[model samples]
Target: MRIFSTILDTVTQRLMSEPVRHDPAALSRIRRAMIDLMPKDANWEDERLRHRLLVAVDPTSLWFLRVELHQRLGRSVGEEVALESVQALWPLFEDSIEPALLGKRPGRRSNNQRGDTPPGR
Candidate 1:
């Protein structure tokens, strides 16, 4: 069992360290989808994020932005809606990010973790 654990750790590390090659078109599509999800009455925060997404040159930047994007969606739409929308975007990152990273939404905390229910819940 110890040997098996060591092998698993090694494999996981390799997968985490391996770089991904993303297609330019895929990036564009992801940027577009994120922008489209922005609320119509977008504030400076929205514009700032939009610009970031537009100028992002790597999957890492976009991946980090997912948290902010989910927050914006939750504030504007709702938690359920935001979760669904963000989950929909996960496939777009499948080819450009590690599967381990994409396994869960970033910045999310369950009611037990947060000690408070989500808005409208």
Candidate 2:
């Protein structure tokens, strides 16, 4: 996982270094996406601020963060990018956002906690 993270980090950095990163519209789009995707809870304050800061100081990290968030929320990269509005993506991620805001891995909620019957039952 560390190796994969490293490779992703490198690639994201390279991609972010392109001329498109300097475009005002592109930057606006990224900022809007970050704000829209961030959970509305105090628990995620630090993480949200960190990502916002990265958008200015290290956009590659911000890009990777968004990618991870999409993955954890179970949205394909293509689907996420293809959406006409960031709001459209939020509903799809509603189930996973709380866990993510609480610093927990999404989808780790057991069936028992979700009130679902056990596998053998």
Candidate 3:
């Protein structure tokens, strides 16, 4: 069991250190999805789950996500939601977040790698 644990830890560390290439289309879509998602989901009203998501995300990402949320729900909802909603909704969103994030990328390993941005307007 100890040897297996060690192996798992090593693999986890290696995966963490790998670099991902910049993907403009992916980042754009993610940003758009983040915006579009804010008001669509009913569970986002929970406070505890909201904060946990915020805590786990990068600050820049958090800021953008929050802005998206705030724009739709308004300042009162955004300011107060994290105080409690994050805990309640934590499991729902967190469980699938890693896959959702990686799946959004445009890398060959991404689920929909062939996805392309629309032609220039």
State which candidate has the highest TM-score.
Answer: 1
Ranking by TM-score: 1, 2, 3
Q: What is the TM-score of each candidate against the true structure?
A: 0.65, 0.32, 0.24
Better of 1 and 3 by lDDT: 1
Model 1 vs truth, CA RMSD: 9.2
Candidate 3 per-residue C-alpha lDDT over 21-121 given as tens digits, one digit per residue, 9 for 90 to 100: 43444444444444434444555453443554334334235433543454445543664453333223223333233534423343444233421211120
**Worst 10 contiguous positions by lDDT, candidate 2:** 112-121
What is each predicted model's overall lDDT from 0 to 1?
0.76, 0.47, 0.43
Error of 3 at 55 (Å): 8.0
**Candidate 2 at 87: error in angstroms?**
12
Evaluated against the true structure, the overall lDDT of model 1 is: 0.76
User: Which residue pairs clash in candidate 2?
Assistant: none
Counting clashing residue pairs in each candidate, in order, gives 0, 0, 12
Q: State the displacement of the C-alpha of residue 94, model 2, in Å, after optimal TM-score superposition.
A: 25
Looking at model 2, residue 82 earns an lDDT score of: 30
Q: What is model 3's C-alpha RMSD?
A: 12.2
